[model samples]
Target: MEMHIRSLTKPDGRQLRLYSRHPIEHVENAPSPFPDPLHANPHMRWHPLRGEWITYAAYRQGRTFLPPPEYNPLAVTRTPDNPTELPPGDWDVAVFDNRFPSLSLEAHHPPETIVPTMPSTGKCEVVVFTQDPQSALGKLPLAHIELLLQVWAERTLQLGRHPDIQYVLPFENRGAEVGVTLHHPHGQIYAYPVVPPVPGRMMQIAAEHYSQHGRGPLEMLIEQELACDKRLIYRGEHAVAFVPVCARYPYEVWVAPIKAVPSFVELDEEQRADLARALKTVLMKYEALWNRPFPYLMAWYQAPTDEQWHPEAHLHAEFYPPYRTPDKLKYLAGTELAAGLFAMDVLPEDKALELQNVTVQLEEPAHA
Candidate 1:
């Protein structure tokens, strides 16, 4: 049987060729602006990277996952005098593996416990963007923000050398409403022996796309988006940041290199620095939205250490936050809890324009 695909343009203008039997239903003002569940949005999305299309449809639920207030307690707090205990100050970007780790670091195939016996060894790290009690990404200086970007690239290269690790996912979480467990300005990394489901699905779809169409998925996306510039947030010599047409989250921004490269280690120094500058610029814009520490989840996508089938992989990063208005936020409800489909209320274009900005105040330092 032949597979049928439907091409559609999202509200923001990201071109999508959704795989389906019949043509996709295009509503006049669908997902119409209202208080909808998170799952109502696209379960996954794709873009041009390296030479393939990567899918992360199932992760849309993550945008509005239930909040466990217990995670961020209000018992005793830590002060500048002692940061290791109770609470932590906003910090310079710090890198560390995930503790509530979804994947293990070393394969211990001894007995049965939570998950089936699969050697799921991976790495997770956090990058604290500031050291102030009240500081957000937009409130950081160009120097400090640049430093954070440098650290992200440097860490990606360091983890790519791990023999057992296959994929390295560096991401951040902000805003208590977004279900952030910790209040610090930080992001995390997950280096796994196998690529996650989302990226894997994208690689699979790209395989089909490659067999039928002779071009890279992300390559095409870059060309198409650059030509339109509707959702195009910013473009640099090596990178482009945009809010995808079918964005699952309220304000979702993806930034990736124009040319397909699967790993940060493959990026030249100048290219890496360019990425850093772009990151700082974009993040500062995120903070300027509400002048508070806006909650966000940022991640860097790179090749798995085991460079097998790398032709199917592409490299990029993203920032997806659920905060709709400065004070208003999107919450996860029943539909999203049971099913994986996401429902976004506001249009992607308005959300991106609302969040994107250049004016911000930096967090104070010792000299200040």
Candidate 2:
């Protein structure tokens, strides 16, 4: 898989990168809506009881909200006067520095707090999935989707090289119910100075499991799921998607490679191809379930970029849809919010069956 990339500096001194499978023929200078350079200085405060860092970025409140269709910021710049984030190009995907980042590499000057405080010297980047604002991730061509996976691998490698960045997370929040301010098909990457609490706990558990059994918990679970043939959504040669036996959400689904691949960069060509199909299968099922665009939070988990070999870490994607039923939503209550325990009304098997019933047809990979 050969990927052509071009990097440019926006007017605001932000980095913009354009990627495509084919050689990029047309190009325009990158533009920014904001004329001034970024002044991002986020800080992290220690939570004594929780044993975690809480980041505070007051500028995020002023980020772009649900703007009118005419003012879509992710759209390609149409005129010189009306500039958008992306320039006119033949790029399959675009990535740029977030104008209102929660964490920044330029962050400094920790506030004088009683508790521990430090500069959030991390990175935040926005990934525009496509030039078309109307299309969704699952709707893209298989080859295009594969390119995205490659792009993610590239980003992980680039961000992980920074000594200050210990972990990198790529995630997407779709629909207004999930507090998606922008209707554009996009996602964000957050590189952390230290491994966050959730991933830290997950890594600890995986490490323990690996030490005891010589395999990660997710790897063991995948074997059991494939053997049982129950709660399986998509079962490809190199990858699989299913609802876990211990799913926290009613319609939760997980997509992963059959092998215990640690991160995006570790995915082989066959694994990457099959993983893309598995992802598309689950997403298409979500939209077909209700015959409308589905709303969900998709997060990818992988090994931390702390310059350590992690045989315990397994690469996977988790989908947490907001809706339990067609018209009903699964709202988090006291137990879920306060106590961190989730109570599901429906069974994981039933939800799996529901998704299994929805049929989706995918087209072959496209090439020019």
Candidate 3:
């Protein structure tokens, strides 16, 4: 499949990169309406106590809220009167620059202040999973999910090559409880100029473990989970998904490649397929657990792009579902928010058993 690429410079000087498997003529004939001009004033402040960068983008406050269905911006445009972000046509997958990005490549210069600060020179792109806005990721066919995975790997490789970007994160926020402004079934890719805090701390721990032992911490964790067999959800040939022994959320699941890989770009075709299947299985189980649309945050943890290549760093995806029961949602309060400590109500082993009991249902292809 040939992907046609084009760049458009928005009125606010931000560059939008468009990627589509369809012909360029299709996109040109039905160009999407330009979004309202909005400038991003992004800057990163040094957190002296935490020793991490704190990004602030004031313009994001005016982002589109929960608009009505008729005005869904992420939907594929069907008519010129209702043009969305995507051009009017059938597209297997589409990617474009985010209208209200928290970070941008064309961010304004940082002002002089007593505290140290730097320009938030990064890129944020939206990954539209399907042409149909209402379709969810788990409901889509395995082929479409595989295509989405390919796009993610491509973007990871492309964004990681940038000299300024230090970390490339691909993630999804589903449902309003996860703070999703749009109801579309989509995800996002954030290329951070600096390594984020969570991954930074993870790399540090992994490095310490590697120095103490020969193998990486992720490999050891997978082996331990397999040995226990209680937390193992799905074990594929190339990938494995299991609930961590120390899960932070009630239904938290970690999916990782059996063989250590630093980033999605390193995964081969077979590994990608296996990872997709493992991911789909976990997502399906989540919905089946409550027999409703599950709300969760899917976060991909990949190695940084900088020269500090930690051999112990392994690629993984973590799911943090808010629901602890059918109607109960886990809210992060005092202990978790202020003290940075998690208190789980359900045991990881029991949750894993519950997920393992749920059967996987195969669905027909929703998109080509």
Candidate 4:
């Protein structure tokens, strides 16, 4: 597959990222003309959450890596305790409203009342962690990682309480491989007026699982995974982080509450700290294996708190790092793009053990 490099610039003069493309689909083993309704096209994107599908067959021409326009620069930065100066405290993890939000906090989302409408009405914020530009969570000390987890749990809890807000999505975009523009150690929160699709589908499946098996779907997965011990990444007291049984990526890791709380924000102080330890362990392992800046997207899924609709939503985090082979990335091509199915090269069991047994040295902190 051919590779190309591109860049997207922010108004602040900071280039958000350099786009290095890789052929997601390798047809060396497939038949000449792939025959299936799923592969009717070469590349397409189904915007499940937005209820739309976009074809990227012309991805090679000119629209490969055009970055979206900058939204609110003011919202991306921190709101200092004192408006006249920089933030006073040194924060390892912090939560703030996302500047480039796909959703908005609708003061009042009265039933459409228009011809065309999309649910861009929600809230999103960026969670900036250290002032340093190149700090990754794995590099942070265990104590700092603990504090960061605390911030995540707190934000989820506090944001979930809003009468207008339904779901709180806390996610982080790491490395250029995953389209993460900034090098700063930070994440984001999207407080939605409605539950997003992935979680929504999960809620549907979970409800069905509960009705049929008399237990949560994730509960079923945790049981099978723990006993199987194949995809288990890190098993801690309060939480269990592991790659999924049918992993979609090379080293995709998920963190779930073992106690089966409805949401992550519901986790107590101790549970939050345990989550921190488990997460740090996963990132550290990934770094050790890759040995460089291992990139991945870390996302938290919570039950959208509306007046009351979705009942079976269980909170969890998804890590979808595109890096399958070292320096190689998995792009969403024909299969994932056209069809909903996902294909991965690495075995989950092997990746799990590799991450579990691997270790790394923490970077020393700078003295103030």
Candidate 5:
């Protein structure tokens, strides 16, 4: 697969990196109808009480909302009448800089206030999985999924190498229930300047576990899940997907590498393929469970770019679906929001059994 790379400098001076498997027709002076306002002055404030970094991107309030199908920005430009983000052509997979990014490459000096604050200096990009806007990741072929994984790994490695970035997160928010503003089948990659609270806490806990048990928490957890075999959903050669014992959501599944790997870039070809299969199985089960499209937040947790924090970290993908049943949606109530306490209605083992019994019919081709 020959990939042609090109760079486009937007009118607002933001650079968009374009990669495609086929030749890209260069547009000399394409008019950008929606020019960036250049008002994103994001800053991170230290939450002294919670000991976490709180990012404030007020400019994101004006981001593209639920637009009509004709105004889908992620779709390929088929005619001059509709000029999307990508060049006017079809693409297997395409990635470019996000127009309304949470963070920016151009660091800014925050205001001088009593509260501790720093400029949100990082990067954000949109990864378009397919040219067909109607398709979802679960419905894509295995080969396409594998290629998407490769793209994720490449982006992780590239973004993690930046000195300003501390953590690189690739995540997808599917369906309107999951707060998806766009209907297109795509994901976003966020390179954070500082490690987020959840991952930071997890890293600390894993380090403590390693100090006591002399093994990573992820490795131990995987071993225990495999031994119990009750909550395990799908066990591949190199990866495993299971409903965690203390699952906060009704159908939450944690997909992790059997081996102790720090990030996706460490995965070999076999491991990547196994991960693709494991992810597909879980997604198919979700689709079958409701007999409708499954809305979920697919989040990838990787090790921090700092090498010192690498040994204790492990790569994992977590699915947080809001639906408790076909018509019911689980909303984070007071306890969950105020106290950070989760209330799950279903037991993990029972949910696992229910998912295991679900029969998934794959109508799409497995491979390209």
Candidate 6:
């Protein structure tokens, strides 16, 4: 479970860290497409009606989007003259400070407005899943996938230690349908100064449920899903993946450890390994189900990183696929958008059957 890390400061003053199972040696300094220093000064405004904070970063409009097939910024730097975000090295994963982040640690000087305003004092980072831009997460080896879980655990522990950060969310948006301009297999980490609305309500409800019954809501749901076995996709020794009975999306699926592990930092070796298996199973099924690349928003939810124990929090991942069928997409409109209530056209059991029919063989790479 040992990981070697090499930290480097990019020419543009951004931070880059490379991780590997073996020693990360003989790697050149990190590179950046921009040469000038990035002076990010994002701010947050209070929404009186929603009772929440809204972050603003006008510069994010200029972020790299839909680049030509020849040029990928996430790719390893080929020549020193035209460098990319990463250095050519034998690293499994790479993480760097986002050039156009919605929130920044250096944010300051909020402008006067009618609503309350403050500096967006948080962090946004991009996690490059692999060196190859064409590869997908499910195509990775099990050992490599396990390494990603470890990387997430390390990031959560490090970012959570900051006093200004209250919550950390790791999520991925796949395909152009999900507004992913970059086709690279990667995800993002958002360390928030405050707990966001969705996870905030989730924690509140979980705490209430845990108080009434000595288990979290997800844990109780997991027990029921396991007992029912109708919507079950992959049920491992320590982890499980299933379609929830009350799914909001047409092809929605949930993955989690059998036992309630509050966060990635608390997952044992068994739980982490099994969790990777379950994740890969779902991703592979999604691809095979439609005979094409599936587009989905995958989000991992854990406890708030406010330096307090949260026994009610249960670590889990939810996958919201956009497609209702092979060709048609399920759009959120009317009641779904205005009322915050999701309308599903298909049943969860029916969608679960579609994924369960696809067979996937988890094989290790020859080198591994």
Better of 1 and 2 by TM-score: 2
The digit string of per-residue lDDT tens for model 3 on 1-368 reads 34555555644444545555565455544344554556666888888888888888877776555556568777766787656676655456777777777777777679777788988889888888877777889878777787787788788888888889999999999998889968788889899998899998898898899899876899898988888788988888888999999999989999999878888877887888788888888988888887888999999998898866667888999999988887889999999999999998899988898999998855632121
Q: Which stretches of candidate 1 lie over 4 Å from their true place?
A: 1-93, 97-102, 113-115, 130-134, 143-147, 210-214, 309-312, 334-337, 355-368
- Scored against the true structure, residue 135 in model 2 reaches a CA lDDT of 96
Tens-digit per-residue lDDT, 132-212, candidate 4: 555677777766665565566666666677776667777888888777665667777777656666777777788898788
Candidate 6: clashing residue pairs, number: 0
Off by over 4 Å in 4: 1-86, 90-92, 106-115, 307-311, 360-368
My TM-score estimates for the predictions, one after another, are 0.65, 0.97, 0.91, 0.71, 0.90, 0.97
lDDT tens digits, residues 1-368, model 6? Answer: 88888999998899998899999987978899888878999999999999999999987776654446788899998999887888998899999999888889999999999999999988899999999888999888888888999989988998899999999999999999999988889999999999999999999999999999998999999999999999999988899999999999988999999989999999998889899999999999998887888999999999999988899999999999988988898989999989998878789999999889999876732122
Error of 2 at 53 (Å): 0.3
lDDT-sorted candidate list, best first: 2, 6, 5, 3, 4, 1
The lDDT per prediction is 0.55, 0.92, 0.80, 0.60, 0.81, 0.91
Better of 1 and 4 by lDDT: 4
Per-residue accuracy of model 5 over 287-326 as CA lDDT, tens digit each: 8887888999999998998645577778999999988888
Evaluate model 6: give its lDDT.
Answer: 0.91
For residue 265, what is the lDDT in candidate 1? 59
Model 3: pairs clashing at backbone N, Cα or C within 3 Å: none
Among all windows of 10 consecutive residues in model 1, the one with the lowest summed lDDT is 27-36
Reference-based lDDT, residue 43, model 4: 26
Candidate number with the higher TM-score (2 or 4)? 2
